[model samples]
Target: MSNEDIYLCIIGLCIVSYIPRVAPFLLLGKRQMPHAFELWLKYVPTSVFGALIFCSIFQTDSGVDFSFSNISMLAAIPVLAVAAKTHSLPYSIIVGLAAYWGLQQVM
Candidate 1:
């Protein structure tokens, strides 16, 4: 595509991507969420994290791998422990990455 076309495409993508993110805050900033909804929102992050962790641990290019050799499942043990103990997302992520890297090195 031409340079102008590329520029237009980039700008279009930026607007498309930005709107969904900004629209929520723009629309909801002044409103107070219901207590039940707020309580439900609290679990969203944990649920997403759990889903991601399990997907990474259980799935591979070939198929599911639940054997002892699945390093991610093993690494998750310490990461889960750190997350449970500290309740700090950053710390948990750092420990999880370090554990994954160390396991990769060893196995």
Candidate 2:
């Protein structure tokens, strides 16, 4: 493809990528959202985070990996426990990194 085509594709991609994100704010600007909808929005970040983390933690080059060999999955065990018990992001992060580092050293 020519440079012009590449530039146009990039611009088109930028527009498409931004529309979904911007449209909601534009449509909802300065308006009070319903209680149910507001309650539901609270879960969006958690769900999105889980979706993003699930694949990297659970999968590998060959296929799905749930074994102890996967340090990420192994590390997640203590992270989950600490996060649930403490409900603290910093503690969870520290535990996760430490767990992963320790597992990496051992394995």
Candidate 3:
């Protein structure tokens, strides 16, 4: 496309992408949510995170594997423990990487 056409397309794309992201802030910025709903929202991120990780940790090439031989499953134990005990993402990540790496070394 020509320069003007390309610029118009870029502007249109920016507007389309920006509206959805900005709409939430504009709509909710001045509002006060109920306390219970706000508290409920706290679990959203970790729930989503756990949903994503659960499949990778438990699933194998053949099927769902819950056995100790599953490295990701094994690694997740300490990762979860560190996350729960310390409530630190960096520590959990470090423990996860260390667990996965150490497991990779041995088994």
Question: What are the Cα lDDT values of the candidates?
Answer: 0.89, 0.91, 0.91
**What TM-score would candidate 2 get against the native?**
0.63
Clashes of each: 0, 0, 0
Candidate 2 per-residue lDDT, tens place, 10-60, comes to 999999999979977887867777899889989999999898889879988
What ordering of candidates by TM-score runs from best to worst? 3, 2, 1
Total colliding residue pairs, candidate 3: 0
Instruction: Name the candidate, 2 or 3, with the larger TM-score value.
Output: 3
Candidate 1 clash pair list: none
Q: Model 3, range 48-70, lDDT digits (tens) per residue?
A: 98889999899889999999899
lDDT over C-alpha atoms for residue 49 of model 3: 85
> What TM-score goes with each of the models?
0.60, 0.63, 0.64
Of 1 and 3, the candidate ranking higher by lDDT: 3
Q: Give model 2's clash tally.
A: 0
Best by TM-score: 3
